[model samples]
Target chain A: MVASFGPVALAVAIATVFGLLPLFLSGIIVPKKPDSVKNATYECGVETIGPTYIQFRTPYYLYALLFVIFDVEAVFLFPWAVAYRQLGLFALAEVAIFIGLLLVGYAYAWRKKAFEWT
Target chain B: MSFLSCPFPALVCNPFGLARDGIYGLLAAIVPEPLPTVALTVLGIAMLIAIIALTVMSQVWVERRAVAFLQERLGPNRVGPAGVLQSVADVLKLLLKEDLIPFKADRATFVVAPLVVLVPSLSVWSLIPWGPGLAIADVNVGILLVLAIGSFTTLGILAAGWASANKYSLLGGMRVAAQLISYEVPLVVSALVPVLWAGTASLQGIIESQATVWNVFVLPVGPIAFLVFLIAGIAEVNRSPFDLPEAESEIVAGFHTEYSGMRFALFFLAEYSNSLAIGALAAVLFLGGWQGPILPPYVWLFFKAYAVFLILVWIRGTLPRLRYDQLMHFGWKVALPISLVTLGATAVLVSAVQGTAA
Candidate 1:
């Protein structure tokens, strides 16, 4: 396991250095010029209207949550597929049950209007 | 035939005997056995680093040229032959640019998000058996590991978008989270077709089974699964036609909008490298990975990988971005059901065949 992770650790370290070091060097090398307009949020060429930060609708969160549950469940299907031939009918039956459960969940969500585009 | 004059001279000279004698001499002199495992580990790390670096650089140029060709314009031709060095030049420019951090952004999470995206993308390569006995790990759960690591990328994208503290960034993050999670199901389900056919989660075993007849030919459903996998994989990586999160026209570069210089570059690296990862996985799972005549295994592996990468480039150049609602609907309504049904049918067929065979 240690040997296997050696490359990953090195790659991460290199990526971190590549990402952070240049930024640090630039801050020291470049001149800083500050102004109110420079720091203001860019909204095309038009004058700023309303606050830049505002609370978004909750539906987006619901969509994302639903996505996660389904996405992960989907991932579980790959391994089952790989072992499909070996699992034979038994594995197929098991997956059917799994999909059935997921469909039920989907139906409940649909009934609750989780997917409604509000 | 006279052994001395024949090509069997090496055998006649007792090469093994001589080598054994030499080893005995070395043992007498207190020499230890060379650590082949350590050497192999070091070599694997070096090779992986090189692969990641090259994949990122080459993909940048490929994407630019592909997009340019599609738009009927010339892309970067001055720096090197056929603008091959354009990506290198971009790297230099990024290196010189100012690194900016938004004042309101969460610094730690903001800094870590890129790493989170990049590291998993790179690590997935470990489980990918490039050729027989060529991979870093031939673990039985290799396929599972790849899926797990692939999904972690959604978290990274969300983190980058949320921590940036910009409205666009937050929106981008939410979009990415939804997109990635939604497409992941179809991707995994499609990948399962091969595993089910091969009956092993080990990548090497899958490829070995394809030696006689490629999986693409074995089942009529294989190509469909490959297609689904490719589409979903592209969406997972947030590429064109599914790049709602980073819709530059709308989100101003999306999740990494607030990032600059190297921080932004990390995200770029992650995105391109992840593309290569998915491309490679697709080639191995669907195409006959490293199973061609004449050429060595590693060479065939690289060819398949590059070919898949080119396909991605072609799609990016040819296809327009899907509307965000369309993207979501396609994933949930279309891909999910298709994959689920495909998986169900595949299961039934495999069992029926096994029952007959047994």
Candidate 2:
């Protein structure tokens, strides 16, 4: 039964090698002849312009922040769900309260248009 | 042969189990103390990798042929009798191409990014229950483990995009992160339907609970949960029209734009493998993993998975990609609220039924 850990550990270890194998093999098998022109940042053969990193719009960050709230809500719900059968009606009442609190936050977000992409 | 004694539905008439036990007993005796376990582990892991690698190769071929057929093209029929060897040929070609590193790119991170993306995608396949006693491991937290490992793909995409130092790659990476995180809400919430109904998170246990009726047919919210899981699963894996992260026309291959040779191939393989993994998870969770009256359990599982994949391909062939804003809107506004309500309703209904019965 200890062998059960075998696939899991082996997978973790093998994942690195799996990722690295092609890179390593390509390093050995493939021919590399690099020049400045070939290695330049690809911009349709035009001269590279400003810095590659640009400031993204604020909407992305807003979306991510909202996602974090829902994600945590999901995590909290999991334990409640797994033990829901044993928890009885008291548990249902607690969940109703929990969801109400989360809904308050959700309603606020909706009213504020945080869900809007623009 | 003692290991064969484990009570499992499949083992009752399983020829594979009988044959596998003979090898297990022989393997157990052939090695010295403490070494046998390690040897078997190596053998098991190696076989798993081999199976997955072969599946990935064939999957690439199937996608090409299926998509081509959908588009009324003949597709690759020259290589190895009906293009069966096309993926193998493609692999050779990929291996021989120059490994390109973009100017000003972060070398170490760029080199490692594809691996990071691919490793998690492959590792997620380990916990899938192909049949009774046929999974790699049935960890109690198997479903949670899958959801957690799945999120790692987004991180890997972010790393690839940032390390490339390309504007397109950065956009792709950010989009992947946003999209994946948003979709994870629905995925996890819908998945909880199965977990809650089955009263266990173990993949096999969920399937066992569905022995009489699969979750998709089991009442008020089962179909709703399955549909939510399906949509979220598709978005989770970055398929069209949800594939804004790597939208080809807009971003020129997105986060992987700067990658060439095997590195790009790794990302490609990871994408398809992730698709397959999500399909298989859907099969296990809703359609009843490896459960059927005719054929074998694993066969049923594969049939359902490939059916899911075919639907993905059909969607790809028919639908136009959504805009970035539209993608985010769908995830946040549409998917999130519906999943939350469904979860609440399911909880209430389940409690009502169970409360009365008790």
Candidate 3:
């Protein structure tokens, strides 16, 4: 396990450098003369709106809530899969039950149109 | 025959591996333990990152020209022999542009968001099995680790959107968060099927298990799982027809709307890198990583990965962008269910087959 993570540590360190190097270089090399007109929040061609922070009736939250639940359930399948060959039929049935139980919630979500973008 | 001629059987595919061993051999001969190993690992990862950059640049050039060909237009033929140096030129210009942070944007978060987006995407490559025994880390829980790391991009994107303090960016961020999370379910579920099929979480083991046949050829379940993974992957990277997040027509560039210069370039880098990563992961899982005849294993991996990516480029060129509502419905209602069922069925069938064989 320790051996496996060696590359991960190295890669993270390298990628961090890769990610930051350009920004660091650009900060020094790039021209920066910030003016209010230039730096104003992009609004295409429109002038200053009523309030920049507009309240949105995002229908995505329902989907996000469902995602939180189902995504966790999906995570649970990983260990079960890795150890599957030895699990035999009994564990298969148990997993079927497990997935079946989750599908109930999925079906309920579907019935309630939790997925729909209303 | 190949092994007889070359002592290192996988030398063609495993350059980093060879380099690591060679580094350790020379350094160990000269110095001592642990330090040489550390130095070798650092060098390997640095090389890996450099190669990823080269691949991403090539992918950028290939995509523009390929998509243009799809539309019967001559694309980027000017710069250095069929526009091969176009990405290089674009990078140079982006680096010199005025770095601007929007007046209302959260200064620190805005600056950090691109790095947050970029690091995880690059890190995913370390665990990818390019050829047999070619991965930097053959972690036991490779698939799970990959999914975990890949999910962090959503966080970075949300930060970019929220930090920008712009209405369109905020809306785009929220929409993207939902899209990514919803698509992730199918992606994870389908990814795990190959693990269950191979009976190991090690990506190299999974690839070796597919030497005789690829996972996509498995009857009943393989094609469904591959289809689900592909669609979710396209959504995962915000590619069309599911690219509603950054739909230029609707959102004016989505979460990165307020970003400019190197910051904006970082986001583009992350996006393209993630797309290429998705292509690679798909090649590894479904099409069989580094498993082919004649060509070297690493070369096969690259061909398969680029082939998958070019298919996506074709998709981007051919298909119209999806409406946000349609994308959400497709992810949650359509893809999620299909993948879930397919995974369950795959588990059952694979176990049954193994049981009988035993």
Q: Determine the TM-score of chain B of model 1.
A: 0.88
Off by over 4 Å in 1: A1-53, A75-87, A111-113, A116-118, B1-39, B356-358
Candidate 3 reaches a DockQ of: 0.72
Error of 2 at A33 (Å): 0.9
Clashing pairs in 2: none
**Local accuracy of candidate 3 as per-residue lDDT tens digits, B1-358:** 2321223355665655666677788999988787887787777778878988888889899999999999999999998999999999999999999988888889999989999899999999999876656678899888888889999999999999999888778878887898899899999999988998998888887887787779999888999999999999999998889877788898888898888889888888888889888988998899988777777777878888888899899999999998887888888778888888898788778866766222
- Mind giving the per-residue lDDT tens digits that candidate 3 earns over A1-118? 6788888978878899998899899889888798888888893445546775776665666777788888888788788887877777777778889878878988898888777775
Predicted model 2 interface RMSD: 2.1
Q: A1-118, model 1: which lDDT tens digit per residue?
A: 6554454455445545544555677667644654555433432334335644577777678777776777667667766665565456666667788879879988787788766654
Of models 1 and 3, which has the larger TM-score?
3
TM-score of the candidate numbered 3? 0.95
Fill in the DockQ of model 1: 0.36
* Model 2 chain B lDDT-worst window of ten: B1-10
Output the number of the lDDT-best candidate: 3
- How would the docking of model 1 be graded? acceptable
